[model samples]
Target chain A: MTAIAGKQPNYKVAPPKSGMTIKQQALINSIIVNAIVILLVLLWTIPTFGLLVSSFRPRDLITSSGWWTAFVTAFQSGAWTLDNYRSVLFADAMGSAFLNSMLVTIPSTVIPITIAAFAAYAIAWLEFPGRKAFFLVLVGLMVVPLQMSLQPLFSLYQATGLNGTFLGIWLAHTGFGLPLATYLLFGYISSLPVDLIEAARVDGATPMLTFTRLVLPLSTPAIAAFAIFQFLWVWNDLLVALVFLGTRADVAVLTTRLSELVASRGQAWHVLTAGAFVTMIMPLVVFFSLQRFFVRGLMAGSVKG
Target chain B: MRSVQLNGGPVMALFEKTWFRVLVSLVMIMALSYGFMVSTEFMKNQDAPRAMLAIVAILVGVLGIWALYLTVDNLVSTFPIRIRDFVRPFVFIAPAAIILGVFIIYPTIRTTWLSFFISRRGTGVVPGSFGLQNYVSLFTDPATFRALINNALWLVFVPSFSVSIGLIIAILVDRIRWEKFAKSLIFLPMAISFVGAGVIWRFIYFRATFGAQIGLLNAIVELFGGSPQGWLRIEPWNNFFLIVIMVWLQTGYAMVILSSAVKGVPGELLEAARIDGAGEVRIFFQVIIPFIMGTIVTVTTTITILVLKVFDIVFVMTSGNFNTNVIANVMYQQMFVQGNFGRGSAAAVILFIAVIPVMVHNVRSLKSRRF
Candidate 1:
């Protein structure tokens, strides 16, 4: 891993930098970079922004003009209304779906994080046999698509009578979520100062005590990161919920409900926009509030140990 | 057992024994398991009051495990070091293991088995009809073949574009003052649900029969005097349009990751390249890219896996019609819409097979990074 300084090949020099001579080149580079970056940012953002604007415009106005045109027309005509929100929230029963989403999401997020935290603590700190094997299995499990688990999982739910319950979706999410949860927490936990755990052990604290009192307290950042991640994941998930917790109105979460809304009312842009925003609000808030941890988690997911 | 004479009563002395601690843990585990099973039954019956009661019971069950552990210190003190160490990890690992085993591992094995069975509507997997018929049909069916080709198209296009676009953005935004703001804007879509993203992009790709095309893409095209096109329904090209949504959603992820990796490149090396008369392109290709090659590969593979499992966009945007069917979406249709569990399971297994090599590469690269 040592840097091989002398063995490096050197390219032939073209010329010495005439300080002022490069100024024009630097200016041109800056212009190109700024232009490209701005274009990219606009391209990345305009779709969502369009939808956001369309959500705020009147239903008739939305269908008649592009969202961009709403700036001129809707403002001139005073056509913006809260009717889409009213209809989506009340008439479309999205309010119930929103609550159902929360019920399914909170437990699903918490259960996996709790279980993964314990497993991560042990795998990271404890002296245990089959530890590497356990970790490798988790890493391997990360690639097992949720699609693969649907049919059998449904039957398992049927056998256990959990097919259409909130708890059923929660457990299904927990199972699907564990691999990444454990992997990320383990990465964060293993990198923690080993001496902290060792010092706890030296004081005769049991593993459980050290975990709760020491590791859990200190691992809050990683916990928060994984918590946000799992929350957003379970919140955004459509497949798992759709499979285990059928489309029963009593149990259907926001996604299944929203997708069904799309299926049934495909061209209803006004309601769909409002509904989409409602579904996105919580995750967006979580993302903005905890942007740092979210970015860190993304980095950890890709740039692994 | 060496019983230390203590001022406490016989109850305290009994609690001090290793076997007593073992007995307590065993009883606590059994009780927790029983409560878990009972709560699940309540869940199945859809008994509302009982379901709420089950939550309380489960909470008490979890708390009991915590309460048991709070008292375990003295119990473990009596055990020999070998015995104590051997059992400790299990106490922490068992909950995760049981959940993963029952839900993930067991289901995976069952899915593979079910793939060999015949599709029976409603009930799933007709017995004695077991064979490779589903897999056989998976290869032969034209629609399935088209889905496979579409998946291959996704595999080729999505990752390459996402990684390259992400890398380009990462490099461009590096020296800018608004790096954080720019990155956040790009990463914002990652917060949007796939279903939500589908809705957002539907506006962009929206088309109509006549009059001042409302969708941005068509608006721009029409503004230039080109006719409005139904972008999503145009076959083959439709798949690419759907992929654009994926790329738009994912490029930010790749950017956030690769941006950090680019920041990690040594300043001295870039200076050295500049001094050696390497132009921006030369220096980028030789120095910067090589240094961040590992991250690029990681990002590519990560996005590749995402592209393979892409369902929501197809599911929401077109429901896999207009020749946009992907493996995962097709599998969903078979299992849920068509009620053909065997065929669906087979599609899922094919997906599983597709993801393995990428996962292995990821694991190997990660393993190498450890040292």
Candidate 2:
């Protein structure tokens, strides 16, 4: 099943001879496929590429001309500048918002993985009452609209003074992230060799020791995958941050801050372009660096039950 | 504590007693909760060094939970062996269950309850205001009606477009040498937030009235001697434009999954189809697609759920202006902007109801796989 013969040059089906040989037909087919794929790739990338180019162009140039114009004058001294990024980072206070995103994202990722790993181990291995029912309910909860929980959670936060605090957002992210984390981890933990777990038990390893020493190490790939998913989700989240953290400058993360910039300065493309890239830069780095693990996590988390 | 053994003296025997162990567990839980409260209180203090306080709070919250779990697990071990087996699972599961119950399960119930009442202001429901008035008005209101229609359009277009485009790209890219690089470029947008994507597309859809036309679309139009257009102000079609952005961001996700599934289809099966005189298109329809139908359903439903709750795109690009209101954005408007709790909760409940079928399907599939 893993063999992908279609990628090979020699894997073409023989076409009935008409005006040309079968080799020529295969060549034509390959060229057509490559052209179409390249065109689609360009279509998918140009929007992001436009903004990226615009971010580096000077403010006057960005407003007065198309980003494509900068490429015509690519080596000219006046074509590019760091002024937009400078103004965005320091003048617009995205620097603090960037830090705030980190503060909110890290603990949110760690706490959920920690909590859900324990729960997944229990659900997978332990002889618990209602284990099947609990697992089923968690699966059902995976698709529950976050909108359903917004108002009441906001009310609860207001009552408890969790609204607009770092602690509140952290706990809120953990709670919302738990169902998927536990479910994904459970899939991995349950599929571990059963005899390995039984071996530890027979050798007098306690559940806690077994989990820490054996399960945790063996499950690093699953744990790392969920960490990236949760990290990206929390970092890029807007609704949760808006509802729980509000648009308060001190607590605003990158999404809330960037959205606020869009609202208040819709015409300021210079700042908006740089500001948008600022928010995107981290996720892009994580994506390019950890694309393999991210894709594995996405498939395991979504495609499988 | 590590030095102590099961063979220790009477003092250890007291620790092993079921009643004493239960007391210790309860005390450990309360202590953890107390520590959390105190640290959060410290966080609430404005005079404290903000970063330091945040760090301390994180340490306390994380460490405190871990400490509670360890203490409880240890206590469970001292119980009779049969009881320990059962109690230990609950001990492992308690934190997750409590948080889910409090954060997700309870709020869902409360939101449903709130939908049954009326609240002009978000303070609380009015006395004697128990009825279906909120839902009735929800279905009747003009603005919300537009939102419902837009949501329906999103539900139809986003998933179908994303899945089809992704599937085509998956199949085409697989036959090429630079498959990984091309896939990464297409999939790059998935790393971007919806708000950031909105900003990126705003540059494309940006309309310049009196300039060289910085937006690419406007630039192309002007290059052909046509005037720039305010693309977002056009009614109904503007909704389609916004939906396009979602498709752009989500197509990569669908592509990645569908690509893997396409690769998983057996090479022998394709060869067999070719031997039977089936063309490539015919083979794709007959052999390849049917082989990955399960994955297609999975990708479609996943994208469908995302489309159902789409908010950031509309919220950022137009704030639901120009007839682009979706259910989630309208729910935000009623609840937060208008401070009308009842209407908002009713809107939220509509989203919840829309997702129920997907949820049930997911649970059923999971059960079938496991049991």
Candidate 3:
């Protein structure tokens, strides 16, 4: 961190006053590190790039053309076209599924964060009995696999007449998500300096007032970080929505809808690629907007929001 | 002391003064009423012809008794003259607790119970007494035994490999200028859901086996004059390919945590080591690795749990066919697909039991960590 410290900004800098050979070794070391990073990045990005490219190229071109081959005439047997995107979007069948994803993602994200914030604040500030035991259980919920309880939950949902309903999915997501959210927010918010709350309290603020006026502002970074994760989880969810949303196209999420699209029209790789990218838009937006805080917040280890 | 008595402590304390005892008595009386009333109602409905309604009534009757006391308390002076110190936190965590218990805990117990019975297609319930028959059959069956072994392999390789790579990256990236962007690039896979990533990898690993080759992997192989092999169709080895997808998705998460832990290593210690003629490799192992061991263990255990319950990837990729079945996916087939809820539930119970030892140890370690 202090490498740039005690340095003159305008002067040409000399390195370590070491021997020429050592300096050469350091330069070589940096190159190797950068080269490895570049290679890894290409390996990671090429497939997605290929899919994206294949999505746009005429279907046959995708079969014959390397995504990287677009650079040459030999690979360019056909011109690029929007046929796949048009088929997925203008085609009345898939458009509604896109809307359905919106419905699930929006509410699934909002309700959990709202409830968690309130509960987290209470756990953080409010004194009560069995708090330790409750905290323990909340953390433990993180370990239970969703698939294990899924059958019993299905039966329960059936009994409650919530099977195959948006409301049911909402409730299920909230139920599954609450434990982690509370544990995370509780860990973060509770560790905030008690002086902030006490200072507010001394001014005759009630608990609610103290939380809203003092705690929430400080905890915003943590809340935002969790929101990004929960939003992505619910958005990219397939099995949860599949079991609860039923086979109906009208209620299925982007994931379930996309998988169904794959089976019914996997031939149309064009739309699948576009649709995948479209589904990716929200998370990418969320990630970029909160990128700086992402590392800091995660690194803070839930102890500081 | 005089003020304590005078202020309604115990100077021949009036009913209001001694209301704590009264409240306790009232609670006991309400609980007794609830138990008796619920038992009577439950007995009345025990003979109900419809199985579902009878079960519902049994549940409702028991819950109704507890509801009655809560209602009665609300109607009267719910709060004592002095607020109960513990009530506020209960109010805070109560909603979360109640939902988790009903949804998570109750279902867990239900699964364990159902595992004991037989729900074959031949009968509504597994028509027999409870024993270790299902578990015994599970272990004895060659197919199931293989799946159990595969799941164990996943537990060993997926978490450990992903975490190891993450540790390596974290160490490497800490020295880089564009660390955040580089880290996010790796983390990008995690943003894609297992299903979404599964869809993408399917195409990458796509094998037509004949005609014009399209899959990127096979396409590249053919480009290199290598024979096209159906990657996903290969047994045993195919599991490693599947594990790669999980590694791809999770390495970023592990990286973020481990990177943070790596960063948390004190600079002075590393600087001192450097002064003592320690090379970068030695300093990393001796200083950084030891500091981050706790976090690495936590990440490993968490990822192990994920691996043990691994379902979606196998389901989406191989559909658990071709000997790629993990425990959770197999459980689904047995319970839902095969309609052998007993066997399925048994599979689930076994998985749960397998997890408890690790889960208990994790909770203990997590709690034992100083705040």
Candidate 4:
């Protein structure tokens, strides 16, 4: 586990202490484990710091005072206001629903990592015929339930007019993100080193030139960790963009335009706290700039399913 | 004849004619199915110039499937090499097996054959409405038996309080020292959006009837003097305040996968179970919970298949409305707000027979890793 989450454990092998000796019982057990991990990291960061301080206070001091009283009226003057992020980014359009959540998360994360990296390099280095029954039917279609294919793929995308387009929610998020992007790029292109795909097939090349010049550049860190896990599962998808992109406003997206501004500005807590921080500023800037390839592609997809 | 007269005579004898390379691979699969029907009709038009023709129809539908797999690998290298190694791994597994057989295996066998029949108002499916009357009105529907006991109390309290508060914040942030800045602030609500953590826990379960209580859980229940309540309309504890917004958006994906299985236990087996005297809570339940019990059943069956398709925290907090519904928000209120396609394909075939025992324990642990 990345060597115990990157070292620091050897507390001088302290166990046999008595009468508060071993460095004062390891400084009272590191101040009772850093005060219960800073009180469970302040109860998991005070409900996202009380909706990012009621999305910068204003609207009548956020429904008459309480985002912990704007840290005790910190320099009062109508305490904080980017006019609730300039009226949820230009008067509630949430800046074209943040360009329709980057037009439905950059081609639903580059057409499901280019059709699951050509079917995970043909089920990790081709052989052909039913290839282990198409990799155990892509690990039994990774636990099927997208409510059993959303009502017959919404009546086959309303009979091919592909219900609310953008190439029908980018071919329905490349068939619900191709069975966990061909089972996490076939667990990193079937653990590569088969003598570099038999030295690009004994030099003659061609399995489409050894999968586009030897397994697509040694599977770019499992295709950039399943492209940040299919761009934060198609940018925090709200039921596959509300059943294949619908709630219209120029093809809604930032979680279906922040769940229609929490059902038509639910008590306009400053336009649902600056429209839920403009649909959480691109999955919190791709979860804090690729948090180690989103926790190593979420522990290589929950330690292989 | 002599390498077809040194490879250029009548274009290498019409590319070594096997009926002229199967009529040029059936005219390049009918011109790549008429360039994917004119870029899916210029990505469903919307007054043209659409963001430069939908970025040139998403770069010709992802480089038109890599130019139809490099023209079917140069028409399977003009075949005849034992049918070019038996049609080249179905040309790199036919566009991910025809888009996972037309979007998830033929719409999960056409929503389990439209959950056996009868569909009225939302039109279609009627003619001699088949049998098992929509799984007997989805087990005699009292609002789908309160969405099957709020999807079995969100499958037993959202995977046991998101794997026991993500295995106690992955063993108290693996004994701090800013353990990666407190495990990235409890995995920052797994990067928000369950409708932006249901509008940040609907502003900490906001209640406010008259004055003060601007919901930080009704201003700490009106600073301990009690009063304010409606934490998502109380009935049956508003289904555990909508299963504490799916255990606060799945306890940071069970604390970053049980903090990498509690830093994969082994620190000389926790200093040989603290030199045999074993204390630190009995070396965390006998040596780091039996050495991260296979990453705590792989983060409790990957949060029990994401709390059995929970559905955007009860469709953005209580759209299930007091006495919260679940089986994927009653199969999206019986298929798109009461259109009732045979009780929403029998509530999506009871969430595909409750995800066939976690898809046969993830295909028997991917056939015991014999990938």
Q: Chain A structural similarity (TM-score) per candidate?
A: 0.89, 0.94, 0.84, 0.38
Per-residue alpha-carbon lDDT of candidate 3 for residues B129-214, written as tens digits (9 for 90 to 100)? 68777787789988888889889889888998889988888887877798877888887776676767777787788776446667
Q: Write candidate 1's Cα lDDT for B1-371 as tens digits.
A: 23455455788787666687778867765676786576666655654763474465347435644554454444554568888778778878887898889878998898998899997676755779979999989889999888999999999999999889999999999978888999999999998899999888887888877556778999999889998898988877998999898899889998988888998999788877866778889988999999999889878877887788888888899998988898998899988888898999999999899888866865676765541
Highest-scoring model, lDDT: 2
Cα displacement (Å) at residue B53, model 3: 30
Model 1 fnat value: 0.67
- Candidate 1 lDDT score relative to the true structure: 0.81
The local lDDT score (0 to 100) that residue B346 gets in candidate 2 is 94
Q: Which docking band does candidate 3 fall into?
A: incorrect
Cα error of candidate 4 at position A117, Å? 2.7
RMSD of each: 4.6, 3.1, 9.1, 22.7
Classified by CAPRI criteria, candidate 2 counts as medium
True-vs-predicted CA distance for residue B221, candidate 3, Å:
1.3
The residue pairs that clash in candidate 4, if any, are B318-B321
Model 4 achieves a DockQ score of: 0.27
Off by over 4 Å in 1: A1-21, A74-77, A302-305, B1-38, B45-82, B122-130, B210-212, B362-371
**What tens-digit string does per-residue lDDT give for candidate 4 at B1-371?**
35877766788888777778778877987898798888778777755655775687677768877888887777777777998888888877887888888888888888888778888454778888778888877778777787788888888888889888889878877776798988887887777778888888887888867777788887887788888887788888888887887787778788877788788776777766765656788788887878888887877777777787778877777788777877778878778877887778777777778768777777776776764
List model 4 lDDT by residue over A209-292, tens digit each. 888887888889888888887777777878877887788877777787777778876777888877888778777787888898
lDDT, candidate 3, at B168: 84
Which TM-score value belongs to model 2? 0.94
Candidate 4, residue B42: how far the Cα is off, in Å: 1.4
What is each predicted model's overall lDDT from 0 to 1?
Answer: 0.81, 0.88, 0.70, 0.79
Model 2 pairs whose backbones collide? none
